[model samples]
Target: MALMDGRDQQHRPVALVTGASRSAGIAASVVLTLAQAGWDVGFTYWTPYDERMPWGADPEAVTQLSSQAVGHGARTAAIEVDLSDPHGAAGIFETVERELGPVSALVLAHCESVNSGLLDTSIESFDRHFAVNTRASWLLIREYAQRFLGAHGTGRIVSLTSDATVGNLPYGASKGALDRITLAAARELAHLGVTANAIDPGPTDTGWMTAEIKDAVLRSTPLGRLGRPQDCANLVAFLCSPGGGWINGQLLHSDGGIS
Candidate 1:
């Protein structure tokens, strides 16, 4: 059975995005795009550790994201969430209800730490990776399904994954798990009207990418360019909209044609 209460399903839909900081982050960009497209939004951020680090998460970043969304004519809310913990997943939904009304669309774009290469990875790293990247995502979707169900009932879940899932170390393996989980859930949720899909942003111009690395990635991509947050956001917005109802349980590569 679908998880949504019948009464809540009848209302206008709103979207909640995790890890919405920085104009270049995928979650922030998705919220902005969704707002511009007329969807109400709720997003979260992590507290920053330092004042000047350009790449770290900041709770206040959501304010800018929300402001931009609202400016686009969509009601918006921001929250502080530590998505690495399984328990925190439920709280995110609560924030959605308290701040933005009922949530019909969910975007899981936030993650804990980024790592690469097998030799550099550790067991602790493996657990940490799954905790934030795979397990938390699964739990969030579980809660979303348990709470929202039905066709025309309103529910869309788009998660951010990585190309590394195809072949790599902890990071790639973790996202591979997420992909399998999402695809299975999509199949189960489809009957009830919800859709689940994964997207890989493909080396976008975020804080983590050094200029030299960005240049290398751009050159590698078939399109001869690195991804933009908006590129991923555009696909996410469409998935959340009524028009994307047919595309479910799929892994979309928004990576500018990079493998």
Candidate 2:
């Protein structure tokens, strides 16, 4: 079978980053960085309004993310899908393959949370979080392996995570699950030349951090600064490169030495 569109037959790898939308979102940053590194991009996005609807629907964020990719010089496709749905990841990857091409690098950056404590968190929230963070990532890696690894003989997957995993934040468990997923999947894809890894961006300044939280996080970091989406994006670009081919099954913490 021939490779897909966003995929380059010229030997340049194609990248698909999920949940790319905002200027400061890691997914968008990854798209720009990957394009600069010469890889075409595909991404998916969801909006708050879509949360009230049924699964498999497109939202406003998808349009925005797709436009940014094209603006950044990447042959881009932005699909709309509710990532919280069980079938969301698979459907999105299928679209990428059908529309963009076979993806050589996959970035699973979809994350959802309500910021509730254990007592306040409901089963609905927990399930939604896991579906987006852990299960969805697994589905993406599986698709990447089956589709690209067979033909091209090499692939890359980078999952976004947070320090909450080790720090025991409410959603930390989900990040931890992804951390384990990266390692396990890396070993499984080793023979196919597919490498899976993770990035834990601790206390990032993604417009979601309040002034007090940012100050506290910066003070605790050895580098005395919070992480930027660009910092994480730079590493992701390298991991998608030929030089990064050997870096598999590792979780890189881009938190300026903050555990």
Candidate 3:
């Protein structure tokens, strides 16, 4: 949830982006894009997860990201939290609201992806993926909608999605679950004034892509290039905007047709 109902204590909208640990990743772009679009932003990062990735993150990247948002003339908050925790959503919403304001839009962009096929995946890893990518997302959306119910307003919910993981079985399956949860939430929460959808960013180079993988992806994409973080960011920004209110319960493809 980009923690928000309408405006904050200072009468500004606040956006909370998850998984913003990497300078080059989608979370960083989401935070900056929302800031540029004129919303005060709050974001989250997990250092342990970042450290485990092949393209490990700079511990200071969150600090740098928040500062950059500040330069965009929007107030910013950065929280270090683990979405894998069962009760993570409550703390996240509370902290974001306390620091920024009530969240009106929830962008569930955080994911835990270990590149393992079905045979290579372990019980531990599969559970980890489910905890972060699917369970946490459902909890966050639930919390966001509940916050809106108390505050008496509307909200936007846009989750990042993918299906092109040929080998990462858990990642693909969990993300598919995310998409289902989002659509179901959209229907269930419509009466409460919330819209929900997901985006397939498709083969984007968010630091994990190698030279060979990128070349192969380029060959497959009709657009003939790998997606940039900003590509997803722009679509997300639009979905959260008032103009996008009519669009609901959709799984959007923003990957330049990689499907």
Candidate 4:
């Protein structure tokens, strides 16, 4: 743990970030960035999701991320929960409030992504994708809205979205639903002064890209490089900040301008 800067820990705002199981993932970057930006952090991770993916789970991810947050003078809490359960969101909020404080920002980065096209996508897989990506997100936002006690204009919700439907039916369709749910919060939660927005970070290379994919992305993108986790993290931090309070109810493409 790092030395405290004499500021009251109780006064610092807390941010709850979802889908932070991988150390190299965007959620982890968001956690670190928020911590450095002076927001105490709480994040959720489900190792089973990562374990099934090509890049296996890192058992120490939570520990390492928590240590890094504390090193930046931020209080940290990490939980492993399967978001597929309808009741999971409420438990997450309860744990976060108990361990940290009322959440000021909620970053929905958790996703169930398995590649299958319209023809091959199974009914079970489609349902699971919607369960984690769409239903869970809506439930989490509802939990956040109900429990939010922060001052008006201090509440934030940012969800990560994508637009790759071809050969990826369930993931893409669920994400489309997610965008609407997140945007709805912006209008519905207006009385609470919370701002909600979704970000479509096109083709971020979080160790899932092959050399061919990398080459194609670089060639298509004007910036001529793959999107890094930090790129999305920076945007998330800003939206959680006082400066980004005005940006709400929109889906932003934070990709490196890939065409």
Each candidate: RMSD = 5.2, 4.5, 3.2, 2.4
Model 3, 50-165: lDDT tens per residue?
78888886877877787788777777777788888988898988988887778878888889998889688999999999999999999999888878742323478899998846
Tens-digit lDDT track of model 2 for 1-259: 1122333435455688887645557777887788767777777776562344333233444455455555555577677677767776667777777766678888888787556665677787788778888888888787777777434336888898876633234477787888898889888877787888899877777666777888888889999877888898999988888788888888898789988
Worst 10-residue lDDT window for candidate 1 reads 1-10
TM-scores of the models, in the order given? 0.87, 0.86, 0.93, 0.96
Better of 3 and 4 by lDDT: 4
Q: Give the higher-lDDT candidate: 1 or 3.
A: 3
Rank candidates, lDDT, best first: 4, 3, 1, 2
Model 3: how far is 214 from its true place, Å?
Answer: 0.7
Cα error, candidate 3, residue 62 (Å): 0.6
Q: lDDT (CA) for every model shown?
A: 0.74, 0.73, 0.84, 0.91
Model 1: pairs clashing at backbone N, Cα or C within 3 Å = 4-148, 4-149
In order of TM-score, best first, we have 4, 3, 1, 2
In model 2, which range of ten residues has the least summed lDDT?
1-10
Query: Against the hidden true structure, what lDDT does model 2 obtain?
Result: 0.73
Q: By the TM-score metric, which is better: model 2 or model 4?
A: 4
lDDT tens readout by residue for model 1, 163-185: 66322477778887888988898
